[model samples]
Target: MDQDQQWLINCLNASLDPNHQVRNFAETSLQQASLQQGYGLALARVAANRELPFGIRQLAAVLLKQYIRKHWNEDEEGFEHPIVPSNEKVSIKGILLASLDDPYKKICTAISVAVSTIAHYDWPDDWPELVPFLLSLINDQAKLNAVHGALRCLALLSSDMDDMMVPKIVPALFPCLYTIVSSPQIYDKSLRCKSLSIVYNCSSMLGVMSGVYKTETTALLLPLLQPWMEQFSSILK
Candidate 1:
């Protein structure tokens, strides 16, 4: 653990140097630390320091978030590895919720990653509380990149979810797709189309409630897909 801490400190410092290569090396180092135990939570504790470069700290925060969310609350029977607490009293979930306000995209990504992981679980009682957090990320302006990442995560996470959760999430999710599809403001056409495709796929997977979403989802998605598909078909010919 001491070696890992030293390695993290070295990486965090390297991330701040004027040299681009050093910064890149730091980024790589941090990414490696992300795979190690306790490193992510440790980085989270230090990421908000004013002395650290904003970019480096943001990357650390994001990595920390990914580690916590991906690993949290696994059932003992389902585990491939033993679950150990980073800190016995501090909730990883609480730390992630606080990260929603982080002033960096990397931190935002961490929060998004965490939310996506929670969305994959069967915590029906917890869903009402958790849904709002996930929905809030979907609308955050400063965290648009993270929002996109979270939405993709949510789209997949919600795929096999029950109807009660699905209905509530889809209404909010559909409009996001509509905005991405209908707006000319989005510059990358291919990416816009891809985002729409994910919404469509998730919409289809709603199974029984697919009918409930038909009017709104179809109204928003079908027009955009038809022309794009036709254009592709013509090109193939």
Candidate 2:
């Protein structure tokens, strides 16, 4: 059993190796491990270990997350198998949130990938617990793509919630978004405009029908649009 475990671990690590055949063996081992004694949790530790090679550990993390996401959803039979929670579990979202500041570019990219995958699953009402973390990432200049991806994921997560959720979400998001809109920096200008476009596209989805949109929309746009038109008229002179 010890030798077999060693052989399996070797195979698993090999799959992450640069060599193709070794990688294939590793894939086969993970498949076998899924069907064997410890199941996914056995491999999860191997993935979560920071001491491991970043690429190999990341591969393990991705596989383990896929396994967790599949069976954890009551609505969808994720991965179509029973999942055992790991003893030393890692919060996938929490890790990604931290990754927004990772000095490594690939780590930032990995967090973006993780956010995209997690957003596909059904999130609970309490899921807004991560909003502050996502909001923090929105200002991370070092990893703009991660911030952009986080904002998009936040938008998607909030979009399906009740109107009760909006007040909690918008206040946190709007300030940064508004600053993005007002910034003279090229990247900030583009991000702010795109985010506002998304907000407007989904504006009618907001539960508050208190004329807030009518009051604010007209107030903000009329001045800008009217002045732009007047300038155009004068330019023709």
TM-score: which candidate is best? 2
Q: List the candidate 1 regions with Cα displacement exceeding 4 Å.
A: 1-43, 46-71, 74-91, 97-111, 122-124, 140-146, 149-153, 159-164, 186-194, 207-237
What would the per-residue lDDT of candidate 2 be over residues 1-237, giving only the tens digit for each residue? Answer: 356545645666788688888778778767756655454544444453456567765666567566556644456654665544433223545555555544444544455445545555533443445666777777766667656666565655555655445544554565565555555463554466566654553344452533655565444344334433553365356
Across 1-237, the per-residue lDDT of candidate 1 in tens digits comes to: 477656776787787788999989888876666555665467755564436666766766666545555455566334323243636214545555555555555555555565555545434565456656656765665565545555545555655566565555665666665555555454246436645666656656654555876676465546446655654475357
In angstroms, the error of model 2 at 227 is: 14
Q: Scored by Cα lDDT, where does model 1 land?
A: 0.57
Q: What is the lDDT of residue 107 in candidate 1?
A: 52
Instruction: Flag clash pairs in model 2.
Output: 15-23, 70-78
